[model samples]
Target: MIRAITGLLSGIVFGFGLALSGMMNPARVRGFLDLFGQWDPTLAFVMGGAILAMALAWLFQAQTDKPACASQYHLPDTKHIDGRLIGGAALFGIGWGLGGLCPGPGIASLATQFVPALIFVASMLLGMTFFRLWNRG
Candidate 1:
């Protein structure tokens, strides 16, 4: 119950932040990616702030034995990057560049009932389903 509540609250905060930062707008995201053109640096500040916050959280986590709501900290174990990781990252970058909406902002944008965001999210889900089926084969 505590975990669920905390997760919900955190997601609410994150979504609110995304909306407030203009990240929920696909045009703003595309503008940020338009380097050498009319590039916007606002997203960079948002990214930097997120990175700083995560770094601080990591530092704090290292000092604790367990999370307040969980018994153990679930961190990624993979240290070495392989071809699959690189390829997936490339795909993600290509998708973001083309659509101007990654998963987080895309989902957040759904609150406005934007058709493009709905289509993007549907395509994302389809891609995930395809990946799952491919991996099982």
Candidate 2:
């Protein structure tokens, strides 16, 4: 229960930070995406900060004897960047460029009840469902 509470609190904090920092705003994201034309680099700092935070968290986790949470991270480490992965990435880029909402912010942005965020979250869920069904079959 404590772990679940902590996770929820942490997620709320992160989402709030994203919103306060303007990272959750589609306009800011669009500005960042318009690189070749009137490029904005504010997103670079956000990305750098996320990378640093992840690195620090990983470093601490590596040295700790106990798990970060009462859970484990079971993930696949695929070395191959195959055509499917490339195609997915390209599609993701296009979606991000067009809608300015990735998974994280798209989910978080639901609090504001914005149309773009709603559409992004809806499509993201639909895509995930399709992928799961496709993979299962």
Candidate with best TM-score: 1
Task: For each candidate in the order shown, give its overall lDDT on alpha carbons.
Answer: 0.93, 0.85
* lDDT by residue for model 2 (8-88), tens: 999999899788878788888899878789878889889999899999988977787667666665447778889999999
Model 1 TM: 0.96
Error of 1 at 73 (Å): 0.3
Name the lDDT of candidate 1. Answer: 0.93
Q: Write the per-residue lDDT of candidate 1 for residues 66-129, one digit (tens) a residue.
A: 9999899999997999999999999999999889889999998898857988999999999999
- Model 2 TM-score (2 dp): 0.85
Candidate 1 has its poorest 10 consecutive residues by lDDT at 108-117
| Model 1 spans with C-alpha error above 4 angstroms | none
TM-score per prediction, in order, is: 0.96, 0.85
